[model samples]
Target: MHSILESVKESPGFTTGLRLSDDDLVLVKNAISEHLANHLARIEPDKVPLLQTTALDMYHTIAGQLPHDKLLTRQSRILAQTAVDAIRTTSLFRQLESQLGAFEISDEENVGRESISIRLVRPGFDTDVGSLHADDWFWKLYDFPVPTGKRRVKIWIAICCEQGKSGLILCPNSHKRDWDYSVIERAGMSKPLLSPDENPDKQIFQSKPGDAVVFNYDLLHGGMVTRGERTRVSMEFTMLIPEDVYQH
Candidate 1:
């Protein structure tokens, strides 16, 4: 793992990333596409009218009806959960531990402590082009504090992205600094938001299908518009270890 991290560190972007093989990528993509299709199919015809609505409104409405504990019923949700679990227990995660330094998963019993969360982000159906504001606040509320020596990383997998579709864009290494929550609050007010250049040090990542990108939590990031004819689909998850490391 250290070798992988070292290799990635040698790059200017400070990101060591890889795409899933063609076969695996295809399988994952098919699974997600079918899952989403089924979820939409489950909606009553009368409700289909509502799905035409913007992403933010649709997400809020679906979120209200689908509790966090109940997200597993959807195929996309199940896949996302499985991916997170795999990373948590695999040698891949252990390699990350050595490269990033000691880390621990959040204690399940602790309230208000930063912990892992998985979310399914499907553009177009539940949101429109300008709905990026919602994610700005979402990341702010979930950020957990870490000691000076360690990094807080958030990982995302692009399970399904049609050719030329919009994927996620992230500023790499931006997590090395403290997050500026005031920017998020101000953006929520319909005020002018900072440009991506405001954080030039950040690297923007656009993934192919089945590609995974991991970055520091404090790193400024957001969804990008899908340029292709197809809708953009992806999953995001966060990981953090306690300062003591053994607490988990």
Candidate 2:
């Protein structure tokens, strides 16, 4: 087996053994739950707990009704701060930086915060999650500028998921190659989704709330834990690892 850093350097990315503390996990859960509740047009006092119990249903009930971009929330939501703090210390990141020296993290909004977003995937609903594509495509879609001279590693947390059932589905090794694209229907509209030139194998990595996955930004990844009985909620962020090899 490859070491964590070695795996990240050589493959699609590492899928296991990275995590946050139990107490910190709770902080993350509560923070996102509150954020979801506040985004509702009008707070439904009774159904709010569904944010934790069945977020897919909550999205179907509330966020699902809003513009898709509204659902793709920014990290500025106040309650999200508590959640962000806890995620920053996920074991994999600490270890990565320890060996390579510290690097700046960016939310692309905050000067030094990781860019973060929470995702909800409803079972059997293809529109709830996005089509498979590399993260950098979004930068081009929105004309967002990526910082220069930094290597980006994407981080995904299974905030609410079932082990061996629901998690991340990836196109292995796509990060090292360029893939073609075509328009496809997603979220009720035509979107340019990545379609590999050749049929690719799908690799689904199973994970639970405590676990996290880190991968190359160019890797094709999407869809969610869609095999489970309930909705799956997950968080993703990017760490801007410094490329300066000679000095920290």
Highest TM-score scorer: 2
Task: List ranges where model 1 is wrong by over 4 Å.
Answer: 1-14, 37-42, 45-152, 162-165, 183-203, 240-248
Error of 2 at 42 (Å): 6.5
Q: Tell me model 2's lDDT, rounded to 2 decimals.
A: 0.64
Local accuracy of candidate 2 as per-residue lDDT tens digits, 1-248: 23544556667555456776677667677777766766643444454455446454245445454543553444333235555666556565576566556765556555354556777776676656776888877665656566788877677888777776667887777777777887666546546677656566678777777688777777788776476666677777777766663123
Tens digits of per-residue lDDT, candidate 1, 1-248, equal 34434322333323546445666555554444444444554554444334434242134345444432333332325443343344455444554566556555442224334333334444453333232222324434445244454434456666556544566665555444444333434323322234543543433465766677655434456666655545555655445534333222
Q: lDDT (0-100) at residue 23 of candidate 1?
A: 63
Off by over 4 Å in 2: 1-3, 41-79, 89-96, 99-101, 108-114, 183-190, 245-248
Distance (Å) between predicted and true CA of 179, model 2? 0.4
| lDDT of each candidate versus the true structure | 0.46, 0.64
Q: What is the lDDT of candidate 1?
A: 0.46
Model 2 — TM-score against the truth?
0.76
Clashing pairs in 1: 54-126, 54-127, 55-126, 55-127, 55-128, 104-241, 166-226, 172-203
